[model samples]
Every structure is written in structure tokens, then in C-alpha cells.
Target: MAKDLQERNHLVRWGILIGLSFFSLATIFILIIDFEILRNPDITQDHHFRIALFILVIYFTIYATSGFIRYLARYLNNRYLTRFTALPKLSSYQESFTRSYFPNKPYEHIVILLHGFTASPQEFQFLIKHLEANNIPYISPKIIGFGISSTHLLSLAHRHDWYRVAIEKYDLASSLANKVSIVGHSMGGILATFVAMHRPVHQLILSGPGLHSAPSDLKYKRLLSLPIISSLYIRIVPYLPKPIRKGRQTTSDTLDQTHTGTMFQYLAIPINCVKEVFSAQDDVDITKTQSDQLTIVYGKHDLTVNMSALFQQLDHHNTPYNKMSFNNSAHNVLEDYDKEYCCQYIINLLKNPQKTNPISKLKKQSTTQVQADA
Candidate 1:
């Protein structure tokens, strides 16, 4: 399964190269043909040069704008967003959260949750409530470098810390419950896959899974996946590690496409962190997924991750998966308008763990059709 996904990733990389090639060829063809026909002999050589320069400037201007918005989003996330923390470390905050999500009761099933990148355990509160309402205990660990309480993110090295800590939480949950369910959102969705592959999980749920990546934000990743460029970068990255490559720290105030959790997320990633995410994703394999039951809820309009690519992953595994999507939601599906709907979906899945929901043959199956209006 991992091999197939790797091949698909390569296809995406080559597709970009192919598109650039065709665009360049077309541009050259137009300039040569147009030059011969119009042949502005009266126009000075500098006049033609200036026109080309102006076109280049416009193209680069738009590119730069898009890049700026992306970075600005990251900046705002690192600065303004509220961080939600949970775990043994923040034992002090437990008294407050307990009155809300953690209703004191005997536990049944244990739910282990992982939140999105630059997010905190708070993302799990809604789902956590559903679990507690059903007499289930849960442990939603804060990925080390995230949350408002964290201070070492800039100095932290890689995702290994996250994966290891997450596994530890899963083990703790396993000891506490008769059965275990794992849930992840966005970046956590990717990490959840790693645990589900090797651990004993009764069910697996991914909200806004990040398996599918947007081309524009992921363009820098292509440098590592591409052939000769990868070799050159490999030889050059050591001297220019994460800190230096991270450049200057900065923040932004808003994101163009709004969402409930956007403000809190760190939109900007250090170059090293980008490589870490890619490396982690580069290792995902469906064959390794050990769970007998899987449920994936994606937003039809999610901008952070591509749903089509993710759907293709499970479809290729031919593994039975319950695929659900909400029309009004975006990348942060877990925090969007349909959050209640998301909670209900988990409850339903847990109630019927053996039932299978197949991936759509033509497109993703919508929740309205699958669950039938609550």
C-alpha cells in the first residue's frame, strides 16, 4: 500500500514537471510565431525586452502575493491563536476541563485522539464529550511542539517526538479501556495512521486528514522528491539547518479562507518541519493499517488537504472504509459548522463497528446520504 502511494506521489511530482514543460514550450512557440508575424522592426530592441520584463514582473508579483498570504497565515497562527493543552504535564488545568468534557464516571472504551499541527488537545473536547457521555475514557495528547503552553517548538527537531509520545498515550488508553478507538484531525490524521498500523485499535477515524496535500503549499516539497534537485539539496541542507533556514520569525493577522480553528494554527512552518511532515507522509502505507474498522470524515471544501488523493488511498487498499463529507465545512472539519454532525458520526460508527462503508466508485459519499439526517 505504501509503495502504491509513493508511486502516486511521484506521479504528482512528474505531473508538475510535465505541466511546466508544456507551458514553457507553448510560451516559446508563441513568442517565435508572434515575433515573426508582428516583427516590430520599428520598435527598439529594448522595447521588446521591456515588454518581456513587464510580463515576468506581473507573473512573479502574483506568485509572490500567494506565497505571502500562505506565510502570513503561518505567522498569525504562531502568534494569535489560543492553545488548548491536556496531559500529565498540565495536571493543574484538569480541574477546569473536568467539569466540562470529562464527566466523572466508570470508563468503557478508551479513545485516543491526536489534534492537528499547531493545534492542541482542545480540538478533541466535542468528541471527548461524546465519549464521556457514553462512559468512555480518553487521552488526547498534545503533540510536543504545539499548544499555547508549549515553548520549545522552534528548537524541537522532528516528528519522532510526536510519534513516540502518541504511541505512549495509545498504550495508556489501551490499559484503561476494554476497547480503543483512535481519532485524528488534519496533521494528527497522518500521525494516527502510523499508530493504527502497528497498534490494536477497534476503530479508526480521521477528520480532515492531511494525506492529500495542496500543490502550491507543497511545491517546496517537490524539491526533495525530484531527482537531481534532491541530490543537490541533500548536499546543501546540512550547513543550512532548520534555524538558519527558518529565516526570521514573523506573524500575520488573518487568513483569506476563514475557518473556526484557523487563527490558532501555526500557518508558517520552518523548512525543517516541512521536510519532517513530508518524510512522515512519505512513509504512510495502507497495507500496514491494522484496524478492521475505519471512518474518514472530510470537508468537501477543505483547502489544506486534497480529498481526492486520500479517497484514492483507501480505494486502492480495497479496504472497507466509511467515507463521509460535509458540504459547509473546510480544512478544519472537526471545528466547523458540522462539528455536532462529526460527534454523531463517531457515536454511530462505534455503535456498529463491524458494519462496512465502502469508498465511492465515482466520488466521495456524502454524510447526508450515508447517515440519513441524524
Candidate 2:
């Protein structure tokens, strides 16, 4: 089976190479000179031809730059950031570790925190502190490709491994507590949903759940998964200053500009990991949730996820779920603005399950109205 897969991948690679080559050539030809319109008379005499040629040159340059952006980013990351950012020297604390704030107590509520891509359990520091203060026992498991600075190691982790880790943690929490509540951030949201669907989950909280995406964006993502393209997209973010170095800037300076304090390219997302996230979404059935079991919180200004698409999915599945949208917030909800309010909201919801909003309530009310009319 491995051999067959290998052969199939080989064929696919050849096909992609051929396709890209043809497309690039066609684009260049169309941009440079419309063969039907431009008859190659004299270069100097034909002003239109020269203008078209100049535009074509500019277009090619931009195209080449985009394709090679990966190599340039890799060079910059290795030179300016990785060495002095203090990442290769991972401290014990930087790695994954779990502790119960109030140990040795019969706990009825347990929270499982599944972190996001290329991030560690530390992502949930704020939430963990809250859980501790509330005397709630929780476990944060390390996904295989994370909690470390080794890029190659992180790149190798898959979605199955992430799910396995979550499942193991769930079992541990289940044995210790009467109810297991899952809180997932970003990619972690996908895992949380999976647990809620398959396991005996008491409550689920998703922070910027990265579940569904638009079909066009998904197609673009799949294209990025290709070898040459994926490599570039993985290592490059918008903030990285290309080949341009400021006056006497140290590695720390570069790190500061990119907001990568004390960590080596934390934003350097892995393609395999991304693929795994989308895979989890595709593999899981997220159409509906059990009564009062789910609460999804996302920033209204979240650039990564489509809130409309998510709401549409839930409505399509006839799923009843509670949702909250925060203003002036980005992807990470626990670390962003209004986090405290969200934390209190979660605490209140867990403490007072009766107040939880169920989408089905409106439907039930509508049904009652119809019966009265009939």
C-alpha cells in the first residue's frame, strides 16, 4: 500500500510540475505579447510593443519573487532570528507540563485544554490561572509536533497524533472527575469538537475554533500544501522584513519587530500540521451539538476564520449552539481583549447550567405558535 501511494504521489508531482510550467509559460506569453495582436516588427519603432515588454518583465519579476519568497524567508529566519531568539535553548518550563492547582480533591468539573498549531499548553496560561483559582482540575497534553523549537520535529506532527493526545488526556480527566469540559483554541477547537461528538463531554468551549473555511480558500490551502509552495507559506508571515536590514539591528531587534519574544518563529506554521487541521475538520461530523454542550467564542475582527460560514454550518446542521463575538479581537481569544469577560462567562455557564442558551428554544417557541394558529 505504501508503494502504491508513493507511485501515485510521484505521478501527481509530475502532473503538478507540468501544469505549473504550462501555466507560467502561458501567462508569460499572454502578458508579454498577444501573438495575434503583436507582429514583431522593429523593437525601437513599435512603442506599444516596448511598453508591453516592459510590463511583461515586471510581471515575471513579481512572479519569480513570489515563488522564491520561501527561500528568502528561510535564509532570513536562520540568520537574524533563530540563533539569538533564545529558542533552541528551551527551558523545562517552556516545554509541556501540567499541575492541578487544587490537588487531592474530589472534583466534579475537569477542563481539558488543547492548544493551537506550533503552540504549547502555555497558550492557555490565562485560562489555566482562572481554572486554578476556581479549584478546577485540568490537564494540558503536548501534541507531538509542538512545545519545542525544533522546526523539523514540529513539521512531522499529524492530526491523528493530535487527536490521540486529546483522547488520552480525556480518559485521564474522565477517571479523575465526574464531568470533562473541553476548551480548545484554534486547531484545538477541532479536537474539542471531536471529543464532544465522540466522547462523553459535559461541556465544550472553543476559542476561535478553526473548523470550517470557504471552499475557494480551502482550494488555495490545498495548493499551498504542494512541495515548493507549501515550504514558502509555512515559514513566511507578513511581518518578516525581507532582505532589508535596519541600522545595526540585532537578532533581538528583529524578534521584537515580529513579536516573537523569546521563541523561535512561533508563527512559523507547518504545512503538514495545517493539512492535519483541515483533515480533522473534514473527518469529523460537526453538524450538531448536544443540548447546552457547546459555546463558540470568536473575535468579530478575526482574520483567520469566517464567522458567517461557521454560523451557516451550525444552522444547516440544525445544531443548537451558543456563540459570542468579541470586538477588536484577533484569532487567540484567551489572550485577547475581553478575555476576562469570556472567562467569567464560562465560569458562570458551568456553575449555572440552567441559564445556558439553547438555539432550539426559539424553534420550540415557533412550533408552539404554529400549533396555536392551527
Candidate 3:
């Protein structure tokens, strides 16, 4: 009976895979035909042969590549899940305290590092090393739907669900330290902001918070709100052939190889969730809130979040904060640039709490001071 059950499960898995493969192929065919015949009116009878040849080549390439990509993604995802799920021996220092500042004295503050979308706790491994050296108690939990977190009931609409999850985890971390400082990267930054708004955090550090919206945002919003359209699109588009060369390297690629492999594995997440998290704007009025303790950090060359726009929004909102930009860094500020510098920046914020807004500080120290005095 057990063997029979196992066989049935195997059959089910294969059936799903086969169905998806067929669906993708059909979607590609329809899209290519639709684009060629309906969208392009410039193609005349004289150029039909050339256009047809070009389309065929593009379609075949995309079709073959998509299948290969999906297969690899699935294979890697299974391997990752299996490795993480396996029980391992506990560390000898599981509960042991390391004293750095003073001999036999434990650290007082705890730093909670939150990684961004499609990322795992592994991304913060470097940051963890720095924390250990400083003897700072830190916990980096993989948000649900990412890393080792269960993905059974995961969906794109539930992206903001991390806010509640972070709160629950924060409560657990509070037992370890008198004060908790949260450092969030990308979407994790937005989640951190949600938590900070509700909780009494000592300090809030937002690193490339995924708050900005682009043209694609409008498309997602429309698709997510219309159930019929979204369902049809998902079923058809996943199989359809898209130009792989035109595909941009999203923030997901900047992650460590292992983490990137893990993320691509579960590309089955609902597109709605992706839309909700990426397109959803922060509704909280930072200026009106009494939570004045906040710090914003971003990389100068970040391709994900618009640093300038974010800075402008923060200033317009009159949110009390400090802005720090890493000169040679990308979206993953802590990992991409100097890990030690990022770590030390957090340490400085903890040691000396700055009250003045970062923009105000700059204004106060402007070169006009010398001219005004003259």
C-alpha cells in the first residue's frame, strides 16, 4: 500500500510537469502569432517571408531556453530544500555567550538583520560574521516563502504577511537584548518599516527599501485586481517564449550564488504576490508618527530602488532620519560594498543616536556658511 501511494505521488508530480510544459509551449505560440499578425501592421506581403523566418528563429530559441530554465530551477530548488530540511548536529555554543566589549560581560543590544525579497538568511552571513566579531547578538530569520520557510500556502498577495511574522520574531529576539535595532535590506526594509511603525524599536535602518514604483507597477496593479485576466495571463505567459536577451538582471541576481539558486528554484510563486509587494506603496505617514528613530541607507549605484526619489519623498514627508550612501555599492549595500563599513555604521548609530535629520545636517554644514559670515 505504501509503495502504491509513493507511485501515485510520482505520477501526480509528472502529470503537473507535463501539463505546465504544454501550457508554456501553447502560450508562446499564441503570443508569437498574435504579435506578428495583430500587433505588426507594417509587414507587407513583400516582407512576409523574411519576417516569418525571423519570428520562427526567435520563437524556437525562447521556447527551448524557457523549458531548460524552468527544469534547472526545479532541480536546484529540490536540492536546496532537501539540504536545509535535513536535521544537523547542534553547535556547542548554541547557548554560550561571547563577551567582546568586556570580559565575562555580554552585549546589551541585539541587531536583527532582515533580507529582501527572494533572499534567504544566508545573504546576511557576512553581516553575521561582523556581528559576531563585535559580540552583538543578532538573529537573521528567512522570511516565509523564501529560504527554508515553508511555501505550501505561499502566494504573492501574502507578501506583506512578513510584517506580522517579523513582529512575532522580534518578540522572540527581545528576550535576548534590552534594545532591538532592525536592519532591513530591500523588501525587507519595507517590512522593517511596517514593524518599526508598530513596535518600539531602538533604531530602524532601511537599506534599499523596495518602495519605488515604475511603469511595470501599473501593469501589475491592473493584472492583480482583475482575477480573470490574471488567471488567464499566468496560465498562458509562463509557457510562452519571451526574449531572454532583453530580460534585465533584477536585484535577485546580485545575491550570493547559493541564494540565487535557491530563489530561482521556487519561481512558482503567484505573480500577484510579486505585484503586491513590488508595486504596493507605503501608506504610513512617517512625519506624523511619533517614531522619530529612523535611518536610511542606500548604494550610490543601486539599480533596484531610486535613491534620489526615495530621499526626496522622505524629505517631503518630513520624516526624521539620517541618510548614508555607500560610494561603491549596489542594491545589496552591506554585501556589495564594505561589510565592515556597513557593520561599523550600524554600531555607530547604536552608540551615538543622532537626533537631527540627515538632510538638515547637510544644510547646516553647507559652504554658504563661509559666504554668509563674510
Candidate 4:
């Protein structure tokens, strides 16, 4: 499967290169032919042709230079820059606390809820309540380097750290219940995938999983992978500010309209944290995924991660997963516009693992349909 994916990637690259070469050749031919028809004394002396060639040369030079710099930055970041750490002294905050719901009696199944990077367990507030109402047991724990007042820890924590926390939680859940199910959103989705692969998970529910990043984020991640570039870039700007406190009515007010802005989230995100997320995504293997054990929920308008690429990957691997989508929701479908519908969808999945509901009737869509939705 890996080889097949690699070959497909190579074919795509070659196709792009060949198409560009043909276009360039066609343009050059047209320029020369037009110049001769116009009775130009000499091709070399034609200012119009010289100007066009000059512009094309400059464009290619910039493109080549940028590619070289990107690779150089990645090399330096991997070789030496990884040693640097910017972790902060994380203190316990009320909003960042772990949420665990255990029924009075013994529960047969346990659900592990994992939040996105830089987000807190608060994102699962609605789902938590629904689970409680249904007498379902769940554990929503905060991952390291997130859900805190500072974001510096995100820069220091590697993908392994995040995976360790997930594993620990899964082991604990395994001991407590006979069956385990993991529900992860965003970056947490990737961690859930890792845990599901190694542990005995009964169900794997991923919401807007960060299997592949959006186009803009992909470029930024590639740029930051270069060691020298990452080091120098951090020196200039260590963190990117976030609008966590935006639209707050007062100093003590927490945004109550949604699950967002209800926690002590970081005011800024460490620039280096992008690399950690990229590494986290590397652990996910669509080919290894069991379609029968998977339930996917994603927003059609999600801009944080590349939904199109993710759907394409799953389809390519012939993974016919149970999928649900919201037209209005984005990356935070759990807490976004379709919070109620999303939470209910999850509740139904958990309550009826052995049965399919009307909403889940479309167990899976064809590749063409998935791409069109994306």
C-alpha cells in the first residue's frame, strides 16, 4: 500500500513537470514564430522576445532559490535546532482540568475524548453532557503543551509526548472497561489513530482529523522543517498571537455562547509547534485503518485541514468508513455551528454501535462523491 501511494505521488509529480515543460516549449515556439512572421530582422535583437525570456528566467530563478532555501532550513532544523526548548512552567488551571464521567455502576464500555492541539477538554462539553445523560462513561483528558495559559510548551513537546499521554489514558481505560472507544478531534484525531492501531479499541471516531494539513499550513510546515530557517525564524518571531480573548465582554467573562473561549487557552501559539503537528500526522496510516471500526465526522467547510486530501486518501486505501458531514461546521464541528447535531450524531454512534441509524444510512460514499463534497 505504501509503495502504491508512493508510485502515485511520483506519477503526479512527473505529470506536473511534463505539463509545465510542454507549456514552456509551446510559448517559446509561438514567440519565435510570431517574431519571424512580423519580419523581425533577427530573433536575438527582438526586444519583445528578450523581455519575455528575461521574465521567465527571473521567475524560474526565484522558484529554484526558494526550493533550495526550504530544504536547507529543513536540514538545519533537524540536525541542530531540535535541541532548543521553550517549555514553560505549566500551572493547574480550572478550565484545563481533566473531565471524567463514571457511572454509579460498572460500565461495559469507556470512551476516551481527545481534543485538538492548543485546545482544551472544554471543546467536548456538549458531548460530555450527552454521554452523562445517556449514562455512558467517558474520560476527556488534556494533552500536554495545550489547554494552558502559555503556548510555549507546545514548541518543546514532541509528537512522542502527545502519543505517550494518549497511550497512558488508553491503558487506564482498558483496565476499567471491557470495551474502549476513542473520539478525537483535530490533532487529537491523529493521536487517536495511533492509539487505536496499538490498543484494542472497539470503535475509532475521528472528527475533522488532521490526517493531512490544509494547503497554506502545508507550505508553512515545509518552510519551518528546515533547521536553520526554523532557528532564525524563531529568533525573529518566537510565537504567533491568537485571538483567545477576543470579543470578551469583561475581564472576568468567559465566552458562553460556545465551547470556545471557555478555557485558559494560550494567547499565542509557538511557531515551532507546527512541526510537532506535522510529526503527529505522520503516525496515521489510512491503509491500516479498519473501516468497520471507524466512524468519521467532518465539516464540509473546515479550513484548518485538507478534507479533500483526507477523503481521497481513505478512498484510495479502499477504507469504506462510516462518514457524517455538516455543511456549516468547520474544523471545530463539535463546538461550531452544528454543535447540537454533531453531539447527537456522536451520541447515536456510541449508543448504537451494533446498529446503524437513519443519519448513518449512507455508510460510505464513492470517491467522486467524497471529492465533490470536499
TM-score of each: 0.58, 0.57, 0.57, 0.63
Model 1 TM-score (2 dp):
0.58
Best by TM-score: 4
Q: Model 3 over residues 334-372: C-alpha lDDT tens digits?
A: 676444466556666766676333433433444365469
Q: What is the C-alpha lDDT profile of model 4 across 1-374, one tens digit per residue?
A: 43333432243344446546655765576566654624665545566666676577556645655565566556644554334442221122234334565554266888999998677898788789989989889999889888776666777887777877887798778767878899999888988888876676788899988889878667767777788987798778878765323344322112234544464456567877767788667757855753337888987766677878888888888876778887766677887666667777788788786674554343232234557879
Clashing pairs in 1: 74-267, 74-268, 75-251, 76-252, 81-264
- Candidate 1 lDDT over 213-314, as tens digits, reads 766457767776777876676566622221211121222111213344344555444445666677778766644788867888877666667778777877
Q: Is candidate 3 or candidate 4 better by lDDT?
A: 4
Candidate 2 differs from the real structure by a C-alpha RMSD in angstroms, to one decimal, of: 16.5
Which candidate order results from sorting by lDDT in descending order? 4, 1, 2, 3
Candidate 3 off by > 4 Å = 1-107, 149-153, 214-218, 225-228, 235-269, 279-292, 355-374
- Candidates ranked, most accurate by TM-score first: 4, 1, 2, 3
Better of 2 and 4 by lDDT: 4
Off by over 4 Å in 2: 1-105, 214-219, 224-265, 288-292, 356-374
Backbone clash numbers for all candidates listed: 5, 0, 4, 6
Each model's lDDT comes to 0.64, 0.63, 0.60, 0.71
